[model samples]
Target: MRKLDEAHLCESVGDSTSTYFMKDQKSVTGLYTERQKNHFLVHSVACLGTEMHLAACPLEFNKGNATASCPGGVLPAVVSCIPGPLYTHSLALKKKLKTTTSVRLKGGTHQGEGRVEVLRGSEWGTVCDDRWNLQAASVVCRELGFGSAKEALTGARMGQGVGPIHMNEVQCSGQERSIWNCRFKNITSEDCQHTEDASVRCNTPYMGFHKMVRITGGRSQYEGRVEVLSLDVNRTQRWGLLCGEGWSTREAMVVCRQLGLGYANHGLQETWYWDGSNVTDMAWSGVKCVGDELALSQCQRHKVFSCQKTATRFAAGVICSETASDLVLNAPLVQQTVYIEDRPLHMLYCAAEEDCLSKSAAKANWPYGHRRLLRFSSEIRNIGRADFKPKAGRHSWVWHACHGHYHSMDIFTHYDLLSLNGSKVAEGHKASFCLEDSECQDGVAKRYECANFGDQGITVGCWDLYRHDIDCQWVDITDVKPGNYIFQVVINPNFEVAESDFTNNAMKCNCKYDGHRIWLHNCHIGDAFSEEAERKFEKYPGQLNNQITRK
Candidate 1:
């Protein structure tokens, strides 16, 4: 039976008398019934080679006598075995089951550190902190295409998890293919909580490269002044600024990627805007990069490392990104705050000096026409991942003595009252705005402000809320007659600053007026609804008789 099994025989059939001639007496002592004998032979042969079922294996029946019929009238039965293909289907199935699962870090600014989550089946869940250590974390780091673990964190340092706790008390030997292959306890509701979620900071090679160079004084990681660390003859490490006299976007790309911030948007040679830091020593100068190097140290530099000007103002800055920022208007505030007011000509001197008045106001005689203003509040928010910075630097900002502030960009928002035929009846413009963080979400603090000569720009996760009471937040509608018109407000109209999207920057409202008062309703975001929905919104009948008067 063992030899037949090794031969890969599928099945065999024999009569009961054939068992007497077997070499091993103990192996072939089954029941003597014809059906039972046939079943035993078939099953024994099938189970020998690859454990195949009897029905799946080929069977050969032996009906002829062994010696052409015994001479003494005693017939001898023959035993025959047949072979089939080997049963090796489990090998392919095992390979299929060994595919790696998805893994990622959550709530981290960069890629190498965060709360660890593994995708199981269809849901993504967190790992518990029980017995979590660097050995287990190394497996996770390697599984995620990074290096070994630098630190295995606990107590939810990366923020709390939201889904099920997939694993607990994980014990890895530091050589497993994945964290899943390591021994772990299956988690139950009582086993863990999100506050005890396991996290890891992987030891990435790029991190060492990033540590060799850094950016400082900018609002976010994407935009900052460049600084590099140098080792002296004694092997002492010191941080110093890079001379920005000849810095270009090509050089900036290498700096940003070396710091793991993706690609470069703009490489600034003179970054007075980011000069808030006090590090002023210049180390390397005349850096020439092809934009493909992994580290700034690999780039070409001047042989003598001399700088024409060593001031911090000549420091290099970079704007790194995979995409640009996206600016959007707060549509609800525009509808609720629309009103018309009359201002005397004497109060319009500041608006005229800042160029906030219409084009005709520039040529108007002194103190002649009273400016009729259509005023509303606007809340512009930077919803992108990066801050919205002005393209112009501090030197380019125009100082307005009338408002006592500097305008960074010439045109920020556009206000227009259009006729039914889309002709501009009266238009208003907001001069270069002083971008500041008016409010922010929870856990975020305001960083930029227009007051006290502070840095002006909208930070990420922050909004600039222009109240209705602020000066010059009105449209000079003094030239338009009392009639129905389309009130449109477009934020970031000039696109002087880069943004991820510009399609959602405009908002429109239906307006009706009778010279003394005005009514605005059905204000909505320009890109929030479909074109058909917008057409329906515009087709709604306006109540021209109703007027909400404001003094």
Candidate 2:
């Protein structure tokens, strides 16, 4: 490993050709001069000399930052290992873009650490999570297929990194990345509780759901027009028959605290009239958005809605409704995951479950609307963004859909239903999400908006994982930017069975011959659709097509 006099070394070693003696003794400075240098063969030594010269020539001769460096002068004294050049730039690969190709921009939640990867124009890459730890890494490990459920892992980074993660002012928690990776605020390193937060990007997969519910009834209504009730409103399936019969007013909010933004403002006023049918009236005349104090008094709620102190821009109390505006509200839909114990069934004939077999059929497929082709297209994107940019992920796509057949007629038809004893039959047509059940709750009328975002498919059927629990809304991985994106569902804490005889139909009307008269119906998914809702659906019907349970 050391240098020696070329004469003594080459002679003692015998095979001068095999030993690479330094022709220039000046090359060996750091080690003992009398020491013998090791080399495989003359040719191998010569090759090594070449590489060494290339690596060191720059350090020895290159002008500082100047491009005037000259070629090297070769010699028989083959250089050993050459010193590295002053500097070198790293290289990364890039490629073309293909569908289904996604990269993790950021991720790490629940006291877990996350890592970001790059898929250069077309090349795949890895990163060094030197600061990663088990405490905040479950999401990352799952995303990368590293571990089933992230367990405590230990090791220094053993891979190269790409792109930039801007972790400069960040600090790690002895875990991975930095506490900030989990989207948590910077805190004292040693004095925090076990529950920590982090931030991440991209890569949100469809996991499971947190909760689901069937809304019931409308809150307010209008006049002249006939109000009709659909089979079952609570059941996410049945579809609004029409709004002519009546109008109800009420709003529902399903919240998932983890996901600061994921929540449902169902039965919103904006949604009530999104469908093409003519609504008798917008019942949510004075309802306010639940969160924003300003919007609370703006959305037609009877009273001003109040926002929680925590949320400002949002009506923590305010929510968007689809009563009288565009269909865009209907476009934004929700998806989730769940487990159905038994395929929804019905025992009684009063529109319990199977009655509403006729759901809004899938749109007629066009020549260019092949399922596979559409799978890779942006139709889902445009639809989703319009629908609410719903959570994106596997089993996730924008499916444009609508349910319920419509009927329009005179007040006599509705007037007859209200007067008929067991003769719920009407004389003319009616308007409502559904006709059979025209008991629109006041709260419901305020919420039943018919916005642009029409019916979109959601998380459905997961009887395999969880029994008696059915809600696929939480299956969206899109918009699930790694860091702290939450998966949540709100379940009814009470297991009490509900019975209702209310119709879920309500509306406002203004005709020349007859003045407007507000009507209401009953169903689930509303304030009136409670455990006390006596046989409302008993006369109405429901079906899986509605994407929900019975009244």
Per-residue CA lDDT of model 1 for 1-551, tens digit only, reads: 22332222212323331221112212233212221222122222222211112333344322332122222333222343211111112566545444344666754434467788876643457899999998788778766655567789997776555546788999987667688889998878788986788999875532367888889889887888998998655898888898988888778877876777865678888988785667788878999986556678878998777888788888888888854455778877888888887877787898777766778787777787577788888888765556777777877788877788888888888888888667888887886557899998666688888887678888766789888766778888777788877888988775456554455678888888888898787565565443444555555525321321111
Off by over 4 Å in 2: 1-251, 254-262, 268-285, 290-551
Clashes of 1: 1
Mind sharing the TM-score for model 2? 0.17
lDDT, model 2, position 336: 18
Specify the highest-lDDT model's number. 1
Error of 2 at 385 (Å): 16
- Model 1 residue 161 CA deviation in Å: 22
* CA lDDT of every candidate: 0.68, 0.22
As a whole number from 0 to 100, the lDDT of residue 361 in candidate 2 is: 12
List, in order, the clash count of every candidate structure: 1, 211
